[model samples]
Target: MVETTRRYVLAKRPEGKPDRDTFELEETGVSDPRHGEVLVRTLYLSVDPYMRGRMRDRESYAEPWDVGDPMQGGVVGEVVESEHERWSEGDRVVGNLYWSEYAVVDGDDLSRVDARAENVTLSSYLGVLGMPGRTAYFGTLEVAEPDPGETVVVSGAAGAVGSTVGQIAKLAGARVVGFAGSDEKVEFLEDDLGFDAGINYKTTDDYRAALDDAAPDGVDAYFDNVGGPITDAVFTRLNVDARVAICGQIALYNEEGVPTGPRKLPQLIATRAKVEGLLVRDFSPRFREATEQLHEWVANGDVEYRESVVEGFENAPDAFLGLFEGENIGKQVVKVAEPSE
Candidate 1:
C-alpha cells in the first residue's frame, strides 16, 4: 500500500470561475484510524455542479470551502484499517471523502455497499445509485409531477441526472423531449434511451424553434438542469398549469459578468406555472427508496446509464473544469484509486 497520500487543495477562491490554478495538488502522510473511525483507500470520486457552489464564498444550500483545504464530494473507497465496531478491513463504503488518495472518516459517516449487481461497477454508487440519480428520480417525479401523456422537456438531457429524468419520465408514460450539446448525445437520448425527441442545442441557434418542433403540443413539465437562454425559451412554451423543476444552472456556473436573456417571471404568471428549485440533499431521507427503484429498473433492463471517467486522482480538477466544455456525456467521475475487490 502507498504510504504517502495525495490530495487536491483549493489554492485560491476564483473571482468568477474555477480553473486549474484554483486547485493545488499536495502529498501528505497517510492518516491512521482513530477510535470509532476507519481508514479508507479512495476508488471513485464524484465531480458535480453542486461542488461549484461550495467553492464560492457566497451563501448557498451548502457551506463554502476554505482556501487551502481539500475539496469535498461523494466517494467510494475500501477500508484498509478499522477501529470501529460496524466496519472492518476489506469492507467497501461510500461517504463524503475529500479529494484525497486516503481518508479517515467516522464509521457513522460511511455506509457499506451491500448489494451487488452483475456487470455494474461499484463506482455507480457515486452516480446512478447515488445522489445524482436520486436527484433525478425524486426531483422529477415529486417536484415536476409529470402526468401520463403529458409532454416533458428536459435540459442537460444527456447528463447523469437529466438522462435518468428523461428515462424515468418515459416509463411514467410521458413524452420526453431532451436538449443535449452534441449530436452523439442527442442520438443516445433518442435512439438508445427511447426519448420521444432530442435537440442538439449547440447545433441549433434557435432553441424555441427546436422545442417547437419536438414538443408540438406544448410542454407540461420542464426539468431544467442547464439554465440560461434555453430556459427562457422553454418557459415561453409551457402549457397551462405547467410545472418547472429547477435542478441546476450549469450554463451560468462560469459566468464572470452580467447575464442576458428574457426574464421568465412574467411567463410564470401568464402560464400559471409553478417553478421550484430542487436540491438532492434536501430529500436525503428518501434516497434509499429512490435508489431501490432505480436499481430494480436497471436490473430489469428498464433503464440505462453511461459514465465518463477520467483516470487518476491528479486529473480531477481538469475533469471538473471539463463539465463546462460539454466534455462528458453522462456522469463525469474521477477514478482516484483502483478497487481492491
Candidate 2:
C-alpha cells in the first residue's frame, strides 16, 4: 500500500506576525524515490528565527517559499527507502527538507549522522548537534573573537544560538553577559550556563544602565541575535576595536516597513567596531571540524544545551511563530514522529 504524509503549504503572506491562516495543511501520498534519491521518514523538525525571512515574498539570503508550495526547514529523518549509493534503509540523515512527514530528497542533499554519537538523542540532530550548534560554534569563536578577560554580550542569549554563544564565549575565558526576556531565562544563563551576568531586557528600564551594571568594562565582543533598541544600546557601549557578529535581526523581522530608531553608524565611528554579518553555510567546509569539537565539549560537560520541544508535526507552525515571541529557551524544535523500525 502506498503511504501518505501530512504537510503544510504557504497559503498567504503575513503582514506582520504570521497567524494560523497563513498556512494550509494538506494530506498527500508519499512518493517513490527515482534515481539517486531517498524516501525519508521525518523524526524531528528544527524551527528557527531565520525561517521568518523565508515566509515573506521578497529577496532574501534563502529562497522565499512560493504560495501553495510545501514549506521547508531543517529535518532529521530515517531513510526508509533509497535508490542511492550513499544511503540504505534505517540510516538516519539530516537535510534542508520540507514540512512534511515524509520527504523524497536527492542523495547529495542529505548528510549521514554519525552513529558513533549513539548516546546523543535524535532530536539533537535538529538542535545542538545540528545547525544551531554549528551556528553558535562559528559565530562566537570565529566572528565574535572573544579574548580571555574581555567582556562579551549576547542578545537573545536564552535561545539556542544565543545560549551556545554565551557558553562558547565563557570557554574562551571572556566575561559573558546575556540579554534575555525573562527572569527565568536570566537565571538559566547566570545559574546554569555560568554566564557572568544576565539582563532581563523586558523588565529593565534602561538598556545602557543595564549594560553598565552587567558589562562594566564595556563589550569587547558581541554576538547580536536580536536587533532594534537592544542593538542600539550595545552600540553605545562597544569597546574600541570590538568585534561584532551580525547573526539575526529577529526583533525587526515582522515589522511592516523601514522602522526608524537610533542611528548606529556614529557609534561605530567612535568605537571603531568591526561588524560583519554571518551565515552558517559560509563555513560549511569546516562543519565537520566544528561538529567534532562541539560533540566533544558536550560530552565533557563543558558546554550545555536546552530544547523547548513542541510535540507533533501539526504544531510546527506554532513552534516557528514562537521564535518571535521569546516563547522558548534554547533550541526550539518539533517532534514529528518516532522511528517505525
In lDDT terms, which candidate is top?
Answer: 2
lDDT of 2 by residue, 240-331 (tens): 99999999999899898969998889888888899999999999999988888888888777888889999999999899888888999998
Model 1, CA-based lDDT: 0.89
Note the Cα lDDT for every prediction shown.
0.89, 0.90
TM-score of 2: 0.97
For model 1, name the residue pairs that clash: none
What are the per-model C-alpha RMSD values against the true structure? Answer: 1.4, 1.3
Candidate 1 structure quality by residue, lDDT tens digits, 1-341 = 54788889999888777889999999888767779989998989999987888778778888898998889998999999999999989998999888998988898999877547753567788887888889999988999998899999999999989999999999899999999999999999999999999999988999999988999999999999999988999999999999999999989877766598887788889889999999888888888899788888877778888999999888999999988789998899998877765
Q: Which residue segments of model 2 deviate by more than 4 Å?
A: 115-119
Query: Among all windows of ten consecutive residues in candidate 2, which has the lowest summed lDDT?
Result: 114-123
Q: What's the CA error at residue 43 for candidate 1, in Å?
A: 0.7
TM-score of 1: 0.97
lDDT of 1 at 147: 88
